[model samples]
Target: MAGTSQARDGRMALSFILEKNGAPLTGTSGSLAIGEMGFIISKASSTSAFGDIPVGCFFIASASTTLKDGDSIQKVKPYFLGFATSKSLSQSKNVVDVTMDYDAATNNVSDGVVSSSGSISGSAITETLNMESGINILQSRFTSIISIDGSTIEYKEAQTTEKDILMLGWNFRDCKVGEFLDIDIVPALFSNLSKDASYGSSQTFNVDYTGNFSDENNFVGGHYIVKNVEGLLPSIARPQAAS
Candidate 1:
């Protein structure tokens, strides 16, 4: 077993697709601009009570167009995240132990052993990437910012708001094609930024961001290890009109 075991590469590639409202943004692969706001689509079975059902192929909105609810697009590709310097995933469990008084001498027990109950309480993924360009810095401030058009960007400085929700995809360098990790952040936010510009040094911007998962509509956003079917695109189900 040990000789046959395979090791995975440490290097990973990060990518994401923007979703407007409830639909995904479609565009050429690896062409997403900074400050683009979008949502990740999460679907569950009508019969299942909880959790998201992973789909082989997901949709995206066109970079040249904005999408509204119930809108559909023909293109399907995800944008690559900037060069990542470091990345980590963190998860926590909320546990409670049930205890009761018990006879120590009769039971020969010095500690009470009853039962424990717990559930996933918190999860987050943090990553630091080297910004590819100056404009990429806008990603750090995109939580409350909106792009009215491809050329115009706005900051919601006057309103109380939350960060933009997005989906994160991580592909291992040595993994088989179409096998990767998928995570949906209720909102992905930039935590901090740093830049160094000095003689004989190329300007590199440190873009540190975090993606958080939370329970919403009986669906607790979490990570999914996706293994897409080889040589085939996911089938899309179209809504049928009344007969």
Candidate 2:
């Protein structure tokens, strides 16, 4: 018997075979979301020749950004990724081939977007908030790469302010200093709007995080919430540390 492996990251690729009688279930739809702006789904097909997955039944997708677990936003296609006709797959063929990157904010000096993310592969997507300007933000990077299982979407905790979402990203894991960990956005959000407005105005979330890398001090971690953050946009910036 051969063991199967499946893993993907923002700057990498993840290939897997999702078999369902070599076809989608009747009267059902299949789709996927990468991060805040990458999404695709299986094409609608109800044809089977006893051994062939039709190309019209599948398609390849292009995620404008990337994704991770606990992400609040996900980008998706109205339908397919690529086309395929391996209906007679040898047990299970690679039905889905995907790539992802973390999406970032546009035209902001102190803000940048995270393309995609994953806990797998010794890497993590990150963003830095410039508190100097006093921030008001909505959905910036809402993905969390919990473990190797990949990224998941994070939602507003019970009664959490939208401004506090940035703080929420660090809610889980809380790895100590010197311990390396990766966090990303949810990677899936319905299939249309990335996120809706709150109470008719652009909401805000403040994401302030600290990790004692030299030693284990105290990690204030667990479902950080983005409350009514002001002046911050929905993007994280990767900045060079000051010398």
Candidate 3:
């Protein structure tokens, strides 16, 4: 029961916790409940698991649509996983309103504006009364929550200092191979997305996002829990590997 051989069957559990703006979420009685979070775990590519893990580090692999406790290497050594999918982010500014009480004779093109009676390039600009001079900028950002039905269900307004909430966690059992559990915390924004439709085929929606590691206290970016099945003294998750 010494050396690497003892770790051959070290099948411990793994859990990933989520925090928003530096505060952990509620209802987490140790780990986030299933269905409350969305995740995809798949086999780790040989290239994805090398060298020193970094802060804000994440891996991308084919999405895993199943969650079963099976006794096989395929079930144990999954590498890339995340919480959210079909995500979208957008920004817009408000339009300004003004009084349309301008005198037709006095209002001219010299004011960077064309009057209702004026024509630019020999074309009458209809609906001139509703034209706007400029936009009323907004300091808050709007986020739309889209449903699977492709409907813009609701929206959330967040300040520059605020962010949307996402929580992802897992509890591994009989977790062998990597021998330890790790979590990657990425503060991301979905940049691009697409949807494909084909005959007799499943519709696939893809989402892309980019973000960096959090520099928060206590969390140290992401967290990892080391296994101690043999009841080692003072056993605890070690400090994250050097950045």
Candidate that scores best on TM-score: 1
Q: Score each candidate by Cα lDDT.
A: 0.33, 0.21, 0.26
Q: Choose 2 or 3, whichever is better by TM-score.
A: 3
Q: For model 2, how does the per-residue alpha-carbon lDDT over 60-133 read when each residue is reduced to its tens digit?
A: 12222222221111121221111111111011122332333543433223223222211211111222232211
Compared to the true structure, candidate 1 yields what TM-score? Answer: 0.42
1-243 in candidate 1: lDDT tens per residue?
111134434343333323233334332222223222233333233321112333222332212233333332323233333334444444444444444476333333334332211111111222323322212333435433343545555444322223323344434333343443344333344555455567775555454445444222222244445443332211111112100
- Rank list by TM-score: 1, 3, 2
Residue 241, candidate 1: alpha-carbon lDDT: 15
**Deviation in Å, model 3, residue 228 alpha carbon:** 7.4
> Which candidate would rank higher by lDDT, 1 or 3?
1
lDDT of 3 by residue, 17-98 (tens): 2332222222212122211221222223322221243313322122222222310011111211111122222222343444
What global local distance difference test value does model 2 have?
Answer: 0.21
